[model samples]
Target: MQIEPFTLHVPQTQIDDLHRRIDMTRWAEQETVDDWSQGTPLAALRELVRYWREEYDWRRCEAWLNATGQFTARIDGLSIHFLHVRSRHENATPLVLTHGWPGSILEFRNCIAALTDPEAHGGTAEDAFHVVIPALPGFGFSGKPTQAGWGVERIGRAWGELMRGLGYARWFAQGGDWGSAVTTAIALQKVEGCAGIHLNMPIARPQPEDLAAPSPTEVRALTALQHYQDWDSGYSKQQQTRPQTVGYGLVDSPVGQAGWIYEKMWAWTDNAGRAEDALDRDAILDNIMLYWLPAAGASSARLYWESFGSFAAKDIDLPVAVSAFPKEILPTPRKWAERHYRKLVHWGDMEKGGHFAAWEQPEAFVRELRIAFGKMR
Candidate 1:
């Protein structure tokens, strides 16, 4: 349970090497269709790669991570890297935020200021939080698990220990994507200090009854879920089935890694056909850098291999809150969520945002957390 300071300092040589790899990429032929029906467009990827090689400054991102207060603590034989930003408000709640696949701790950068200093970010002092954003094992600067069994359930247990080690007797938890699975696992385990939990991508699959008698929203949700299964979940299938096979290319080529993630950025984000519409080029590159810098293409994918099926419904008695972003992978209804989360507290059908709720919409994300956790407190 010992905590130690961690600083991000990517060596100059390593950065230079990344530039070389991007320069030497052997790009494939462009997609047949003009749109993104096939995969990442060669033209778009090349444009992104051009910027990454020529102008994107890794050092700038490195400095921000350092200044944001990074730390490492050993738990379950792995050193977990996290950003611990404590609010000045004495009564601020301690909250643990988790990131999922194709994402890193960088996802929460914009959210830190608003959560840690609510007054400065259009909120009263009472809305403040002592935020802890942890990089999931095998992602970012966190130590990769050499052995197996480091899935969501184990991760949930480790988070409990992490908060306890940090001297947080009472706290709230929030997550999206795979993070939603972990936070739900924590609730199922009934982690002692966790007061309540919040989720942006609440994983509640539709039952027979739901399908038989569906509302307009439920019908739309069902259609979206079908679309994901039919078209969008190819990445998940590959990662969960053969992460190592995909890892070889991702780990070797910078463009390969970028293309792998860039596709999701385009598909998942709430944009008008381009990821750039929702997230800036620099921001997208910042996220891709985490995987590239760590060479975590394979290791990060292992979480899917280990816990792909764990996103199923579970009876969780702990107080739960959900924010169903419009373009989330599967925006299930409140009635569906209430089936699994017995003591549901808050349900927000957010007008905007997508799968990466916090990253895509930090203001809305912060507002959800403040309102959701505010109820429990």
Candidate 2:
């Protein structure tokens, strides 16, 4: 598979359309949900919409992202957008970084500099890495997967190919959220050149009772898993069952689009209500616009159905490290992780950070990355 390169070019017309939609937004009543639990509140959406149109600057944000060496690549018929940041030193470890739902390569914004240019970021020059930050197959500029079989595991293969294509014979891997699971797959499945792996969030689901003894903690994990099914997983259900139905609403209104995307970000982050506590306002909007501009709000959701329907996570035999945060919805205990990964190390109770650890806490994020993967280097 060959990769493609793209100049940073966001058209002016799209920007106008987004602002126009924001201006024309007809908001709804705030049916009270004390916090952001129900969804993005109409009040907050209105305020954010106003700021996006009046205060936020698209070209400025685009310029910031453009500095990261963003480019496009074709692998197995998919066009992938990725950041290929090479280190100054020779023999730098290559690390493939992945992002999750409602996230982009933006999650790794702070960690990227630290990982690639370690010496500058207060690390040993020996800890340098050539980082590969890919836009997930359907999520961003990579374009959507039209045919079947582009589940999480297949995405893993595409990433491994991406790394090898870049000429890294061996590399380390790290991720948070869905990225964690994909990195998990890469490490477990023995992707070519994957030396070791690290994750902030663990790929978690209810385990069969017979597979291992369920501790009270494990039982609590199960209950939380079940609660997601009963209460919090409406997005998964809609995405899995009727994505197109929701897509129509998302495709039309930027306010509606904000509500759909922002709520997940709110719930997933360690913040109380403001995602800005962890993410930049423009950064959050950029992720939403990636979906809105591509009109991929529906197609991207199909990934949930695609991954869940067929390729579930397997018991992987690889060196794996996981950093579980307090707000992590999928808290895979060490024992549970041990059952799956043959070589499990570096499991820690993160005092801060939520699903998007790289975005939330980059220094601590880099510190953890250095601890787990710095060994490989």
Clashing pairs for predicted structure model 1, backbone only:
none
lDDT of 1 by residue, 1-377 (tens): 89999987988999899988887878798888998879899999999999999888888888998998999999999999999999999889999999988888878889999999999999999999999989999998899999999999999999999999999999999999989999999999998799999999998888888889999989999999999999899999999999999999999999999999999999999999889988888989999989988899999999999999998989999899999999998778888888888888899988888889999999999999999999999
TM-score of each model, in listed order:
0.99, 0.92
**Which candidate tops lDDT?**
1
Off by over 4 Å in 2: 204-223, 309-313
Number of clashing residue pairs, candidate 1:
0
Q: In candidate 2, residue 162 scores what lDDT?
A: 89
* Model 2 poorest 10 in a row by lDDT: 307-316
Error of 2 at 5 (Å): 2.8
Clashes of each: 0, 1
